[model samples]
Target: MSDSNRTDFTNPSTFILLGIPGLEEDHLWISLPFCIMYATAVLGNFTILFIVKMEESLQEPMYYFLCMLSVTDLVLCTSILPKMLSIFWFNSREIDFLACFTQMYFVHSFSKIESGILVAMAFDRYVAICHPLRHSTILTNPLVAKIGLAVVLRGVILTPPTILLARQWPYCQTNIIPHTYCEHMAVVKLACADTHISNYYGLFSLCFVTGPDVFFIAVSYTQILRVIFSLPTKDAQLKAFGTCGSHFCAILAFYIPGLFSLLTYRFGQNVALYFHVLLANVYLLVAPTLNPIIYGLRTRQIRNRVLHLFTHKET
Candidate 1:
């Protein structure tokens, strides 16, 4: 409503989000699960933060990174979910042009930051397992803080250029975005100007976020695997690998949906449009919902703290 209503415009005063193309009638019904996902993400991520804050013993480099992941999950879920539900339930689909671009930037920014945190987590696990004697010395509070800063800076720096490119383009063309949120490409496609630069930059942003992060993760795991195999006993190896179970699960939950959604749009031309939109939405929302669940179930200390917190509350 705050958007200036000007019909003849470079960028239209507002853009309309279709929520999910080809599934208009199902929006009401679909809100059920989406609402539940948002709730679960909120509660789960908050619980993770709470447990990490309350239990001093659990406050280490690892939990610090987990806390970063939880915070990212919180932002990722919140950035798009409320607007999505509003669109679904209230039919309020108008987002201002600047706001839409801002949403896209933050969505991608926090998303990449999440990936960076996972990479940092992989490094943390590798250090802890591969160099047990020097784990504390290697991953001190200052180093962890620096890594956190670097992760934030990575997202902040990498995600903006694409959105900035998108922003400069004229939008005298249709302002209807077919997806729920302001996805970078979806919005870019709405531009009347030639978007070769935006499109190419978008691809660059994708690779820039995924490529090196994946490389570091792969290297960390490879070294970790080597260290585990070199151990004297199978029990020791299993225990060493076991320490990374939660992080591994968290990584899978975050990346699988993301890569699936990304590739689906790029290669799955036969897939339904609504399926792509739905998958994109899920790709955005599911990690936050699942990250805490993965950590809560798989990480022993946080699990124990969570149980203790609830049990203490009950008594």
Candidate 2:
């Protein structure tokens, strides 16, 4: 009997990725928005990088963190979108077992790094606003570099265990993953072996890796708001709000969809499977596409520099 027909444990060499379950027929059309989002993510992030690189006045801990954010957005989206587009456009669905695992790791790891970057950015804002005089001294270039390295290293070190634990399972069940990409839990569910550990570990990684980030961001913003409200002048208060507003929106863009996706998957079993899959893609894609617009286009310094470049080129 073939592996699919056999009852004993087996590891399939390849898995079939069902692009969007019930929405398979709509994939060609669906790719349109996804394609646009990916393109925007690429163009917008590069634009931020360009502005930060070309404008010396834009060099600060915040912009440096923005650079890290742009790069993470690029990698995070690139990790899955290209393959997802393949599935959408060309109906290419077969992924090697190893490739599937690789994709799962990249998707999870870079996302963790992105969350870390958001935390770092929040801390930057907190320091800048709450301790203005000490902002430069506290977040010096060396410290910024270390912060970047720490976030990057955390993602790299922490994400592999998800893949490792899942890989140990024998694929004695169907290798067909009814999702757009090789999501970690989706892959784990394919294992015929008991997956309580894998499932528990998934929750553990989410809590351990992302729980602190969310908490830090919450605390940072709480202090930031307290400082903002205490400003003597209304103008100063509004100005502070203006500066942090965009950052806050970017935070919402990252976390809200993400939290919804996680909750829906773990609890909302009655939710349509396609909804869950689309929400998964949203957390990964929407933030990347929106961050550049939120920060690069909205922030005064970066916006002014972007305008400077455009005006100079036009002249």
Using lDDT, give the best candidate's number.
Answer: 2
Stretches of candidate 1 off by over 4 Å are 1-8, 230-243, 264-268
Q: Which ten contiguous residues of candidate 1 have the minimum total lDDT? A: 1-10
- Expressed as tens digits, the lDDT of each residue in 126-229 for candidate 2 is 99889999999999999999999999999999888889999999997588998888998888877888888887877887788788899999999999999999
Clash-forming residue pairs, model 2: none
- For model 2 the local lDDT of residue 120 reads 95
Worst lDDT run of 10 residues, candidate 2, spans: 1-10
TM-score of 1: 0.92
Best candidate (score: TM-score): 2
Candidate 2's TM-score reads 0.95
Give the per-residue Cα lDDT of candidate 2 at 40. Answer: 99
lDDT of 1 by residue, 1-315 (tens): 535564456878899999999899999999999999999999998998988898899899999998999999999989999999999999999999889989998898999999999899899888888898999999999999999999999899988787889899998848889999998777877777788997677667667778788889989988988988899998987886776665676677778778777776557789888988888888878889888887665788888877887899999
